[model samples]
Target: MVTGGTGVSGETAETGAGGGEALATLHRVFGYDAFRGEQEAIIEHVVAGGDALVLMPTGGGKSLCYQIPALVRPGTGVVVSPLIALMQDQVDALRALGVRAGFINSTLDFDERRTVEAEFLAGELDLLYLAPERLRVEATLDLLSRGKISLFAIDEAHCVSQWGHDFRPDYLALSLLGERWPDVPRIALTATATRATHEEITHRLNLPDARHFVASFDRPNIQYRIVPKADPRKQLLAFLRDEHAGDAGIVYCLSRNSVERTAEFLNTNGVRAVPYHAGLDGSVRADHQSRFLREEGLVVVATIAFGMGIDKPDVRFVAHLDLPKSIEGYYQETGRAGRDGLPSTAWMAYGLNDVVQQRKLIQSGEGDEAFRRRAGAHLDSMLALCETVRCRRGQLLAYFGQEPPAEGCGNCDTCLSTPETWDGTVAAQKVLSTVVRLQRERGQKFGAVQIVDILLGKRTAKVIQFDHDQLSVFGIGADLTEADWRGVIRQLLAQSLLAVEGEYGTLVLTEASGTVLRREREVPLRKEPKRPTASRSGSSGSGSGRGGKSKAPAVELPAHLVPAFEALRAWRAEQAKEQGVPAYVIFHDATLREIVTQSPATVRDLGTISGVGEKKLATYGEGVLAALHARTPPSGPAPEESPESPENPESPQSPESDWPEPPDEPGPEDWD
Candidate 1:
């Protein structure tokens, strides 16, 4: 247990080499001043030749826990990552910081692979990233054997758990790393994990002695809201236009077709969006991913295949068009937003169909009975989170084994506008009684639509065809609207009082249904909010405070400084294009905001601001100073429009070419 590291200060004992060097490296390379959470301790331990397991939230500076130790230690650090598509960008980001980083992945040609390998052996690289699959090859293992390894950093460590949301079979072989190199220290890190998943990772990776560090799983900057789904595409559009206009985000769908449709709808309605699924050509996916990273305000409509290791720090929102399978998957997906610690949103459109479809999928899935049971348990937890009347954030944290605030987190939809829960016992009985009549009298089972229609006293064709008007339960629920009836059925499904069976998602009664009908169980259900009307006030039924327009700072910028900030962004965009890197790679928006506010006149002065590390200070400092000078506000009234503002025709947001059309059919990877 290496210790002696203080807060953000660089002061430390010589014995704990990482305490001082880690802080120095952070400032010199990444441009941050202090260590966040357990970063200092984790780095110090790894630097002193000890193993560690780190579980921190996204955007919690997980990279530095290993990167700093790698730089401070004697030999190059080898990183085992699961994202082959993102390895290059990861390496590029590191290189932008003036760190010698390389990756050996399928994207590299033979010559390129040999070159990286030579660099590794010659001690010319500080960090080398490899896909977990790469380590399976004999040549790759032989190459590592000849090199002096500083440490092994296993990223996305939750993948080792077979039951984890994003499990990878290749990760199972990672356990061999400890056996092959017993003397070398290792660090395994993941952004999302429950206690069970954490234990599985430890046991799978043979990290019995590794020190465990579990940071709080709460992301206060992200406001979580699950609205009842109406027209999900339109709901998503309203969300984007009202609260997150012109902001970059991700929209997750459960099907490839939905991804395509949503992207097209957003494009036609004036939101720039692109589709990404495994069915698309690999190059197309790569191109789309690159554009998203480089362009501002671009939204990627995708399935789960995207956004595993995305490092974009400025994503303002992550919207789900469908229900995710588990709480772990939901947390991991939503955590992608607000990586920069700026206020962001985790919004979802949940409805009866989502519940029915998810249940159907679980039953029809390829897994055995045990796998289905595990999957069912996962879905149950996610449903509980969606139907929760308490703080959404609190429910999420509790699922991860963290004790949330007793009163509730005030930022989520429930906390912001407390939902009213009514005595739904009667409503539950009504729905259960209707199901019983259908099955017992008619010897028929139908989906939510048929059940809802029958209860609402609607003389639809199916009801009349069955001569169901004679049924005693018919029209008994006429007091409730169709939407209300559907809501009741959805809640019943969530509570396990009702069950979905067969391919068509027919509603059936579970064993618990008997208690509801017997009046022995009291069903309390959240009263669904009325359908939201369109509003431009930046407020809607989802909740208040939509984080405002894109490119806007967390705190409003002074009118006088807005032009300078816009100019800096334009300059940064040009630099990113010229260098083929993300704009944040050059300098984060937070760093640029500070530069504009401070109006640093010289390169040396710019270094004083956070995120202006030594390498960036030397490479882009003069250019940044020049941009600030060019956009100096005139003594008279400010110009009508800055270059990046919406009013400007030449603004990046105005170009349709920035968002390309996705292929008609995406690949058949994993469908909901």
Candidate 2:
């Protein structure tokens, strides 16, 4: 089982000794001079054969926690991933770093699987990736038994938790791993998990003794905004044009039809977009995913089925056309944007219909009473997040059990343009009175529209047919606009004072409605603005109105360096095309930007740049130098060495080096 071979290229034979060696490996292999928060601690612990349960935010350099340990340890590290579709990209990225990584998934042909299996078994792989379902196969277990695994990494560990937003049944079988390989340390990692879900993952993964590391959940780079829905397609188009023109983004919809329609609408309106959903043909879905990953500035309008393990780093925004069922789901989806630590937006177009639709789905969903209750609780939390008048970031972090600063996170919509809260007790009474009159007096149930129409004294045919205009509550709500009445109803539902029932989504009063009707409880609601606020750039020059910090300005190449950046990008694109890999697999945009800014003349100078490890330096250094030279003027001073360039032209730090360190304690904001 321990037979040895030279192993794949970039294989490190030295066993993990201590932090010194780990740092060396980081610099030599990953080309990073420093580790981010808790990265050093996690790596050291895992390398020392300690189990860990890491709750890092997305883009928190989680892969490095297990990867460095794997490289430093003697044998190969076996990673169990749930994203079969993204396994190739994962492996490709590692391979680009000159690491001996391979993946065995359904995407591979028989011969390809066999080759990877042989490499893993022969101790020729530094890392072996397997989809969780692959473990269900006895042959996979047998093969793993024939290999020397230094450690076991369970990626996306939250999938094992049944309460998790994105649960995968196959992850339940992963607990068997600890029993089978008693000596190998195991680390489970996820980008999002609440305390309950965290406990579930620990219990389900059989890692009760594992060291738990819960990083702060704030994604400061992402400016969260929940806008009022009004012709969502047009609003989305306007947002794209106004703030994120030609930027790559994701638009998540609740249904496949919405995904397709949104994609079509974006395309028709001049934004290049593609549709992705489970309903599409397998090949079509794969093709669309591939295109989204490879092509720049192409938006993918998708259902929840997409974006689980997508590693594309330049996504500028994550817009939601429909409400996500829970904060965890919303966080996970929105976390997809700004993975590069640049300013991005988490924009959602929410309206009363979204609340009604979500409630109706829950009521009609196939679940037991307990399940429905849990789903309802989840919806309540999401609705609360949407409705909160305080800092959005604080509420979001609080949901995950982390304390945020007393002041607002000025980056969110609420912090940027705070909405006023008004006493809506009379408005609440009128709406509840209407529902009560319909149910008790007329023995009728009507959806929000009809109720609103009746309350506003509109003699629409349906209202007139039902003689609803004669009701006492009729015309009482005429003081408020139709939009204003809908906001009240939506908030009432959110507060559980109102309940949604039946396929038609008729609104009904809950037991608590009595308190509001009798004036025993006060109702405060966010007042609907006369005009919806136009979507703003999360990275714009405008500061938060409440004095909360805005996100850092977006990273832009200087005009003088733009040519060099573009040329390098063109070269990277061609290389990616020829190699049949995503462009980032060759060199990240950050690295290329640095290359343009520094204008490294020799391969040695290029080697000083972060992300330019030994293998990459050897493979692409000459090409990079050529690209820079081509863009440089022949007669004048080198632009990079010119006075306008950076003063300290020394080797640049990793792109993330400038990123603010996450607060040492639990309360401050952190970038994902």
Candidate 3:
């Protein structure tokens, strides 16, 4: 089984002999001046043959933990990844950096697999990526046994936990890595995991004594904003038109049908978009994912099945049209944005229907009582986050048992909008009184909209059929609009004073409702404003993520330096196209912005930029300098007219004429 070959590239012969050598590789290969937060410590520990459980954020340079150690240690690194896309991306990125890396997955033909296996066994590869399921095969184990492995890296280690949002049953067998390769140090990494999920990962992976490095779960570059759902399609279009026109983003919906509809809707409205879900054919899903990754300024409307280890670094936004199952899921999904360390938006629109559907999923799911209870608790915590009136970052970090900084994160919707809360005691009494009248007096159970109608005295066919106008509480709430009453109901749901029961999503009074009915407890709810609050944080200074102002964020670049930035981006886009890669692979927008600001004239000055590593500098350094030197003064943005110019086809039309009114309110059937 042992096959031999020479180094694929001359750079493969380079090795980090510890101390200064590791630092040399850090700059020369990975293109960084120094290791980020606990990276150096982790690399040192793993190189010295110690186990680690690293909990770093999405763009936190987690690969360096195992990669540096792999290069420093004596043999090839074995990485277990869950998704084939993830493996391909990492291997491609590694190969681009001049590291000898290969992957074995179903996408490869038998001969391709055999070739990679041969190279790995020949000690020609510094790192080999495999799916955890591959480790279950005896032949793969035998192959690993034949080659000396520098370390065992378990990517997305949280997948080992049954309670994790993205759990993979195949990961259960990964514990054998420690049992079989006892001498090899192992490192597990994940972007989002709670204290329980963390412990579950460590225990399930059998790394009981591994050194744990829990990086701060904060992603300061992503601005989190959750808005109340009105007309979801309109809300989304407005968000795109106002803030993220011509930017790439992921729009997560709850169902495949919605994904298709949303993508089609976006396309019809001048924005390019694609739909992705598990229901699509294999080729279709792959094609959509490929376009989403390879093309710029395209939105991908998909289900939760889309993003896991997707390496596109310039995703400008992550919009959720439905509520995620839990906070961990939300964190991971939103974390996909701003991976390039530039400002991005995490925007969502949630409503009572999202609450009902989530609860229904948990209740009818295949699980025991304890499992259901835990799932309910997780949903409750997620609901708490949605309704949080304080700093979202504080609540989010606190869920993971980390304290927020004292000043509070000024970037979230709550901090930026400063929503005002008003006493809802009387409102709660009115709503609770109506529920009591409907069930106890009239022997009728109704959902939120019907209840709103009865209270508003709309006297619809159902109200008249039930003769609900005869009741004492009927028409008492006529002063408030239907929207106002819905807000009251949502707040009550958040307060646990009201519960929706049965498969019908009927409004029901909880024990807490009795206290509110009797005036024993005071209820306060957020006053739903008629207009959306404009966002004030992040780099863009236009309207709020929910959309208000018409003008785009003013571009702040000085007129003279704009040409340099454009030239660099033009060159980067050309390189990316030539290599069939995403443009950020050459250099991110943030790096280019920094380059423009500094106006680096030489390869040495370019090397000093944050993202310009040694290999990248050597490869593109002169080309970048040439692009900068070619920049001419006073051209006004671009020569062929800005894509955002008045004549641009991608520009938004009249907002009112372009979008349909908010779709009719969700009916009871919609909840199912």
Candidate 4:
């Protein structure tokens, strides 16, 4: 047994429990029979007083790694998190499992905070969740000094990396945890961290000695699709109507106004939706988030501000109305869907403007040269993903330094149906030639639209004023529509065959473009797929079709069992409403589906369902059994109450939503 070290004075040093005991507790306390990937090893390491760095996917059981160790170890487990909204829900969920957990943040009053502090010093808490900012206060540190900490679990550890999309300066101070309490073990966890971000986290958090447990970063159940932005609202509506009509999901926009308008548009069109962003009053944001967690089939149209530390696991899809800045940000944002191991969709509609806006923001930002360069690299990776002709999953996983699965994942848009590509050398030459001509011969720098107008011989005001009509290239692309010309231009930009310069996004020839003009390079472009009309009766494409339906949900209860499933869902919702807790907190949809499928006839039978810990089984088992009984057919033979199936572990729960409130730093626009 590892004895106490420097910080162990006046504190209990309980020997770490054996694996048998840990397994027993898993079934007794949390009602799981087995540990997930690397979980058992992680828990044993931390419980025996070893440090660790965990990089698991969103729905992977991260909390359990820390939570179980806290129970198995001698003292309170302190978790440093970012979001206040997630804190209460997490504490609530843990308490439901009969664990004594508390959190101290802005959400609590002085009296409440003091009480939690007192409980901590007395060694009464199994877990204590705190925001990173709380660690900055001297008094808070002083309070921690008086207690025994089993281990320090840093949630969303990627925030410590400056290059991380959700970077928080306060997280940098976490390095002191190692120095201040040299005896205590620490585990830093994140769902999204690339190779660079991973190294930075280890170095920044003073966790150089910690074991790095990098789980497969694949969320195979979420289908990835990227579409061209054309009437975004209509596209989104058609997406929802076709495939995900009654499903719970999130739509992320790049701006607050877009969030509001999209939410309103969805609601007006009969989709229950809410808008969430930093610009909204804190109370309103909280209310909307609470409603989203509590309601079924609700969609939240939000900025990137919405999802961090949000633990609602049944979100059916995540749709991006605008392009995110980097692949890491996209992965983190899209990982919020299909958390329950159910098939979900990750959909997006990005266009030329998204490219221009993101690039312009990066180029003009106040960051130092290195920072801007890194940002540009990140943006370039995301662009490549949008334009890639190969398997998206392969590209996405390869970005994280992992080999893609041997067989292509058939779940993404590319694998379901390969997108067609066209030889674009002629189109590229025409666009590049025009830029060279306008700059060298005409001495005129023009944007894409003006160049397009000159090519199609539109004789628009700008074209006429520039006398571009007299050029040999004028009307040369008259056969292509305005959109087609624009597509060609954007494709050129994407391929680095052209570049957008300065504040106005004017087209400029890159060194790479010179080859195309000289007929030394061939350019290939993605062919834009035909967009489905509003009046079209079917889904625009595969994955998310009309009625917002995917091929199947995470939970596919038998046809005869769906009525019982609905009954149990209704009962859970009612219980949640009465208790003012999110329905998932009472019992996740997965658990209910298990109960419905098993047709549990009594409390004993209900207790066999996954997610039914001893405490929860005692509290809600009777209610769940009754709900099942109400829907059981009269002629059906009642199965005897079966033995408790301890191995039926539910989909890993994610009470930690990671939408860190936009940090106090400069907003995205500040850079540009």
Candidate 5:
């Protein structure tokens, strides 16, 4: 059926779009009030038979991007997913939404797989999820050839990037989608991808001229921070105690051993935590993840593999036990937090070895030498980002080709606590001079530690044996610590002023270094390390995302509703548990806060809060209102309320002790 209507908001509603009226159908069938962002438009274009490559964030409601169109269109939507858990999750979620969905994978025995495949071929299922490996098979391809696939979606599409941190060889074979289903509109979606990775995805997925939907990388709900990695366990404990003392979160580490040790340390410190990595037994890994998702106030120490397909939106914090290799990876990992759109924290405690470890990992990988060199160079750039003396958020966004607005975010460590820097143009020159001298005398001899030792004139067996170490500049910079020199090298590398030269991949300076040597550029470098190094390469937090508190005092609503609000929260958590969904999916804290404030006695009153959709109010209003009436007496009078102050100021405001102090002046915080 053709649909006709002017656009809802000043935008044009182009006609002849694919799955015309899919949005209207979705509203009627799925009970959704409206589409979020470009969802409706993307669905319309797909109905119009155009391709799409969506770069939506994880919690941005991606499933509806294709689901609605699939249901309204003539045939099934083929969603290619890599994991069995993801397939089952989506299929179940769709079915619960009143849409028939099915998946065919190795987990199902032959009979069940055949039954599902047959159902898909018969158009009984509106959506079909398949693995890329399965899709590559002749039988699956033959089955797909007979069906009319309205649209094809490649989830986790960033896996196509060989340059990306998460690369799947099976994903490379998916490029054949163009050859197989040329007529069907295709959409590839991933929560993470930079310009380089994006290009790779486009090329490999053969999604040329596909519309690109890039959401703002800034997750305002997430408080971004990086603490100095000193006595990491203690710092983590302090952070947890101060902020997220009891909340659900993920702690990421770089290695399997670190994952185990950090999880153990955190558990001993009274944080219920589990370790996850590729090294763990399959069943154990699944159990750890299940516990993390189902249980509240649990933390999981893991590598990159754990949280990719997860939907735990209410995570109060996302902490990295080790520095990530790139800002894109870092951003994506942190995006896991505050997905329920409440305030959350993204923190990292990192030091110098994180840089060396990532560099070594890149260098040791089996790939083209030139490629490894590029990877190592990219890793150094990321290290500079982590240790940056400027606004971390600004530097991060700049790397992704988006300039953060000029105003400071006031959330990151740099913005909150500015660091001092010195003009190291001379130091840069000296370092370059040493590297050139070393290259002239011998080939790429050793790693950074060795080179620094030589420059500082540390008398060693190798230096004494190579008596020609009578170099003029040797020992001249002995006053500076090795860490200080390493910082200089990292900065120069980040600025593209240095290069790791030769097939052996030794660090050297590029032509840009000559300008610094000639004093054409003055580099303002850090005088000393501001952040401390964790004794171990990785450390898990005792509790939460301790990015520090905002100077703004906690907003005061009313104390009379404590029992009611707590009851409501408890019920919401239970509902989420029963449904096997994230608690935020049921009700966000913000909405609940409004519920307590508004004390909506009826469904009509619940509609006043901003995020309360008609369906949500219809489904949850009665229960929430019942919780509010749990029959508990009100407690003491509530503390006075104040407007939220800027978070960048001195420190977060603590609530008052006495009920009524001088109106203008806040009294001191009572130690009691």
Candidate 6:
């Protein structure tokens, strides 16, 4: 590793792990006074030249792991990204903060690529971001051997694993990053990953010794909703029209064609809509993405390509057209919204075959048999999520190895709907007994659908072939709907009461399930409501807060300050125009509410609100305070003012004029 000559802080250095001096540089350079979650831990490790793999949430601040260290460390940090958009987005944000950041991807021409490479050679860059495909170039690897690169960060590192939904061949080349730069610390970061995926990432990146910093997967800010995929289009329209009206949101579809159709359909309706997917021309895609990011109230109907690196924080909702392949994909997509920590929603629709079709696709794919099997299991888990009557957030978090200890989150559909559950003691016993009887005779060999059919006394071909229909437990339980029965068996497997024997394992009674077979005790089976397929637009399209109409138009300020508020509102509009950003972005309703409540009369007084930091207060305080001081005379009927001036109280020379007039009038009256 090269010892520092000049650092990203614009200062010369000669040390190793730059210590508190580097941290000071970070705070100054990044404008953040403190770190969030395990940022401090991961930063410390990478700063000390140790490898790390951070699994943080969408807004968990993963970029700082490499960013802060890049400025303080001895060499440029090389971030391996999969998308050109991701590199450019981060580069733009960093440059805004006055950091020397640039990226090279397929989007650049040969000349542009050459220019950035020249800067890399001259050590003129702080953070150098690259597509993993770019790193595969012979010249690129050769340059890495020569240049002073201290950190190799693989963003969206989950792509490296076959287990992840967004698997890419280029990402597998990440192992070369560590192999090529053995001494430098390599940190892999992703917003979503299961335990299995974490292992695959570790092995593929060759960072087995890396520290794993796993943040809580909970997006308590995001309200999770799973509407049945009945009339999804109408439901989506109704949802947008009713709840998140005039706000930026996404409607995700499974196919590029679906994306376009959805976007057009939305446009035909009242919403401002645009379509985005890989099939669109690059420029069109870029323009659409740019509009969605930079402007508010533009809805983008898209596939997975639309949201990998979106940093726009105020996305009001994320609606899915078809089901996502796995819960991980779903969470990450929905997690894109509500990153600003204001309330948002994750809404999706799915039908029965949506699950079957995805499962069929995975099984039919030509990959490692093990990989296909894993995909099937993942699909099952996702199906479980779609069919689950429990807290959707809880199920999602649990899938990622986090436990939710609440009776209900109260924010998800299941909690709000309160699915009635009852003693499955007898039902579970019957199901387990059937599994046991079948296993005792043949083995744990069949899928849940097959097994459920056998227990419900359906004399199908497979059951007849195995003589399972003749079993005593057969026909003992058929009261539940296919969906309901499937849910119970799924829960049993999830709770470790049953196990699949094959790749994902079919239902075989586990030791716990065996207890139910022996009539040891009752098992709780949730009796989900007989809900009609909730049309996509059929959801309770309430505001992000509890229920009913949003407290949005808060009883228009105080009557006394209403005119002052109007003046402030006009000033806000003017400022918004000058800045060329949305008025809400410049100052949210929360900030306006503060201004109305405080009615500060001076710049300093306006700056007293917590939201008005020094920089903003300096820039906007005077105008805002001036508006507040420009009071209106109040309202009922307009006040009429007297024409008299309030200055002089005495009538001017009235007596003198009267005497002069009387002398002329007296002479005339005497003649008459």
Q: Is candidate 3 or candidate 5 better by lDDT?
A: 3
The candidate, 2 or 3, that scores higher on lDDT is 2
Clash count for each candidate, listed in order shown = 3, 0, 3, 25, 12, 6
Candidate 3: global Cα-lDDT? Answer: 0.76
Clashes (candidate 4): 25
Winner on lDDT between 4 and 6 is 4
What ordering of candidates by lDDT runs from best to worst? Answer: 1, 2, 4, 3, 6, 5
lDDT of 1 by residue, 1-672 (tens): 111111111111122223487788877776666676677888889999999999988776678788889999988999999988888888887887789999999989999999999999999999999999998999999999999899999999999998876889999999999999999999999999888899999999999999999988888778998888877777788888878888899999988888888999999999999999888999999999999988998999999989988888888899998899999999999999877656689999888888888898889877799999999999999999999999888899889889987999888989988888899899889889888998998899988877777788888999999987788888889888887888888999998999999977899999999998898989999898887676665544665554444535432456567778888989999999999888888877666667776677788898877777788889998899899999876445544655444452221110013001221233335463
Report, for every candidate in turn, its global Cα lDDT versus the true structure.
0.82, 0.80, 0.76, 0.78, 0.66, 0.67
- State TM-scores per candidate: 0.91, 0.89, 0.89, 0.90, 0.77, 0.69
What TM-score would you give candidate 6 relative to the actual structure?
A: 0.69
Q: Write the per-residue lDDT of candidate 6 for residues 211-262, one digit (tens) a residue.
A: 8899888777588887644456776776776567677888888767667778
Cα RMSDs of all predictions? 6.6, 8.2, 7.5, 7.3, 10.7, 20.3
Report the number of the highest-TM-score candidate.
1
Please write out the lDDT profile of model 4 over residues 553-584, one tens digit for every residue.
43654445567878888898898889777777
Q: What is the lDDT, from 0 to 100, of the residue 10 in candidate 5?
A: 8
The regions of model 2 sitting more than 4 angstroms off are 1-18, 532-554, 632-672
Model 5 lDDT tens row, 1-672: 001011000011112223337656654444333555667777777777888888766556566677767777789989888776556655654554456789988889989998997898788988898988997689989999988788898988998898877788899998788787888888888876778788999999888879987755655556677654545556665566467667788888766766777789888988889988877788998888778766778999888878777765557788886778777788889888766555677878765445544555565556899887777666766777765778777776777777785876766667766777888888888888777777676653454555677778888887767652587767867877776776776666656676654334467767777788777888777655444443232223222233343211122234454556677778988987888865555655545665676567677776654345445667776887788767445544544433432323211111111001111121122000
Candidate closer to the true structure by TM-score (higher is better), 1 or 6: 1
Which wins on TM-score, candidate 3 or candidate 4? 4
Candidate 3 runs further than 4 Å off: 1-19, 532-556, 632-672
- Residue-level lDDT of model 2, residues 76-104, one tens digit each, is 99999888878887888888778999998
lDDT of 5 at 267: 85
